[model samples]
Target: MVDTVNDDTELFTIGELARRTGLSVRTIRFWSDSGLVAPADRSTGGYRLYDTGAVARLELVRTLRELGLDLAMVRRVLARQATVRDVAAAHLRALDAEIRMLQVRRAVLRWVVRSGSTTEELRLMNKLARMSAEERQRVIDAFVSEVFEGVDPHAPGAHLAEAMSALPTELPADPGPEQVEAWVELAELVGDEGFRQRTREMAVAGARGGEQQPQGPDPERIAEHAGGAVRDGVAPESAAGGEILGRLIGPELSAEERVELADRLATFTDRRVERYWHLLGVLHGRPPMPPRVPAFEWLIAALRAHARDASAS
Candidate 1:
């Protein structure tokens, strides 16, 4: 029943307000006690009574609460100390960060399942995969910095070191399984002391050779001729391999020259180093390039073969 405070005004008791607003009497009493939905008057028996404006305020408070706002935020909204739009914008940024973290966790779980990772592997993968973009970049930066620490910055390969350290500005907020796997593998690769030493060797060599134009066989020619021989399964030490090597670096190269060229090639051609570039390609959303290390390995072996044959003769 409505309490007629005047001819024009109708007031509702707690029970009546609950019936009208579809809220519980206990909830209405709590909000009233909390000063969010204050009573407009007191009945003769000392019960809480609300006017129509209170009913509207109660509905607004319920809507805000249902939207995940705490009582304090709702109070601010009700008091006009903060606008709903401003609160919503702040809440959205928080929700986005939370969602991104969950997505990364999901991706890590997927990787764990697919790889059958051990406890230790899973722990490491999770730690690497969940790092922020800056943290991920720092891992690469540290690796590159160590590898090129004493190497000359003006070296031809110094640019390559910079390229090696490149990471996307940020990882995709919702990364796929492959991306997670790439990041984990990359982190491990950079941390390997053996790989770091190999890279440093290449950097130092390139710095030493930077003063003169490289007189080595053309890379394009090597990839074409040597790459073909590798695909065709031609034995590196066989006669046919000699013909390909002639077309590659020219038969005029002395035995010592062949050995020197082979050593230089071997220093830079590493499967793990190539794998590093391949993994970086994956992270950068590039299509996979065919492995070039095998072709180069064949070239190195063939050079050693002919050099050894000449020495024996």
Candidate 2:
């Protein structure tokens, strides 16, 4: 049976403290031995006896331990080496980091489970989730640098390099599955040689003034007329296509001008480049712009067709 001390001056056995605090006898003994709560005196029989103050100390230690504080920190708290408030503030920062890690792991697992991800993809997702903000930015920077390496910085669309590298420094603390998927795809895309080369071609052409529009056709008119034609299912070689062309480019273009316009549109029109911007937009939380490449492509086809007809006639 545990013995109890009724007054602050009276003493209680470790067993009594354990029963009152709901801690195990072994736990109380360990804390007592660790110098956290020393006995007030020893009985003639050599049994350890603790005063009532020991009860409050033991309870505080138990609370601290249950809150994930380590023994060293608990020792510091007991020794008055650190204030409880100071230790608590430090522990809160540690907890925040742990929470962020758990959130990243949860997002990775959720994506893996939903996609039936392969072993390679699983590895990739985990790796990306663990990357620091600087490392993630480096991945995009390397891709942009590779694509725009030799292109003149003064070139018309050279600023596109900056825009292309605009991934946020860090993913949200609790990212959605789509955000994770977008990051994974973005990682894959930057490493594709074909995609790199396509962007390089567009950049190089723009550097040489190939992307600049001459006095031939107004772009807004082409977007309206040609874009509407494409939406209404007008074939580039059909009479309806010809009508749209007239409204866009006018009827007086010589064969040479038509060829030149086709080349200019081709220089700037790459589907992959458009896709890169679209993916970046998604990552940046922007509303998706309606596709303009299809419209430009239709206009290019119409220009080439009219050029052919003029030459043959």
Query: Judged by lDDT, which candidate is best?
Result: 1
Residue 45 in model 1: lDDT: 88
In terms of TM-score, the best-performing candidate is: 1
Question: TM-score for every candidate vs. truth?
Answer: 0.75, 0.69
Candidate 1: misplaced stretches above 4 Å?
1-61, 69-82, 97-120, 148-155, 169-174, 204-209, 212-215, 308-313
Tens digits of per-residue lDDT for model 1 on 1-313?
6787898888999999999999999999999899999887888888878999998999999988887789999999999999989988888887887788789899999877787878998888789877887898999999999999987787677787788988775667888889888998989999999999998888777777654324667887888889999989999999999889878876567789888878878888899999999999988989999888898999999999999665565
- Global lDDT scores for all candidate models: 0.86, 0.81
Alpha-carbon deviation at 194 in model 2, angstroms? 1.5
RMSD of each: 3.9, 4.9
lDDT of 2 by residue, 1-313 (tens): 3344444377878778788899899999998898888998887688999887888998889888987998889999998999999988888887976787788788888987787878987888989876767888999999999999987888777877888899888777787777777787887888999988888877776666633734446767777888898899999878788778878775567778887988878877887778878877776778998778888899888888778666665
Error of 1 at 115 (Å): 5.1
lDDT of 2: 0.81
